[model samples]
Target: MNGASALEVIEAHDGTIDLMVTDVIMPEMDGPTLAKEVLKTNPSLPIIFVSGYTEDRFKDEIGDNAHFLPKPFTLQLLAEKVKEVLS
Candidate 1:
């Protein structure tokens, strides 16, 4: 889903969401920006950011609660990342 819809879902869930997986670059809002906004209310929320770019570029932007998963990742890799972040 897009960033705006993701934001709405998170709001609708009232901070019950365990984690969020999003793309680094999106049409309306970027993942880091979305994460930053979400963190305002759900500071502890874990986020996984997916993109084709290098992880280093987003490391500082994403801060502690977020992880980077480059594009072309497998379902297994995505699962592993979710598990790792949720842990």
Candidate 2:
């Protein structure tokens, strides 16, 4: 989903959001910016950022609750990262 729509869903949800996996580059808003907005309401929410770009570019912007998954990653790698973050 797009950033705005995702934000709406996030805000409307009554239950917990275990994780948010968003693309680093999106049409409506960048992933970091979206994460910042989401964190305002859900500070402890886990986030896994997926991007084709280098991780160094956005490393400083994310918190310990976040993880970076570079593009071309296998489904196994993504699952591992998600499990790692959720754990």
Candidate 3:
């Protein structure tokens, strides 16, 4: 979804979210900050970050909970990373 507000992400989803696949850079917010806040509500949530930058690009922003899926990944690659994270 194209998020409209800075913190309006909570209302963007239907509330039974299983996974959050977000870009590292967006017009509203970056992925890692969003993930941290999203976890406050769903502690068991899984996040997959996508970006063209290197793994070290946002390593300082993300904690141990989220997984990284570098940009330009194939659907299969993204799926595999998600499966690996969920597993």
TM-scores of the candidates in the order shown: 0.87, 0.89, 0.81
C-alpha displacement of 41 in model 3, angstroms?
0.7
Candidate 2 per-residue lDDT, tens place, 1-87, comes to 788888888889999888999998887877888999999988888899999988888787765557899998999999999999888
Which parts of model 3 have CA positions greater than 4 angstroms off? 1-9, 12-15
Per-residue lDDT value at 73 in model 1: 94
Q: Which stretches of candidate 1 lie over 4 Å from their true place?
A: none
Better of 1 and 3 by lDDT: 1
In lDDT terms, how accurate is model 1?
0.84
Model 1 clashing residue pairs (backbone)? none
TM-score winner among the candidates?
A: 2
Cα deviation of 87 in candidate 2 (Å)? 1.2
Which one wins by lDDT: 2 or 3?
2
Which order, best to worst by lDDT?
2, 1, 3
Q: What is the lDDT of residue 31 in candidate 3?
A: 75
Candidate 3's residue-wise lDDT over 1-87, tens digit each? 432353475656666878778887877667777777778878888888888998786788977667888878898998899789878
List per-prediction Cα lDDT, in the order shown: 0.84, 0.87, 0.77
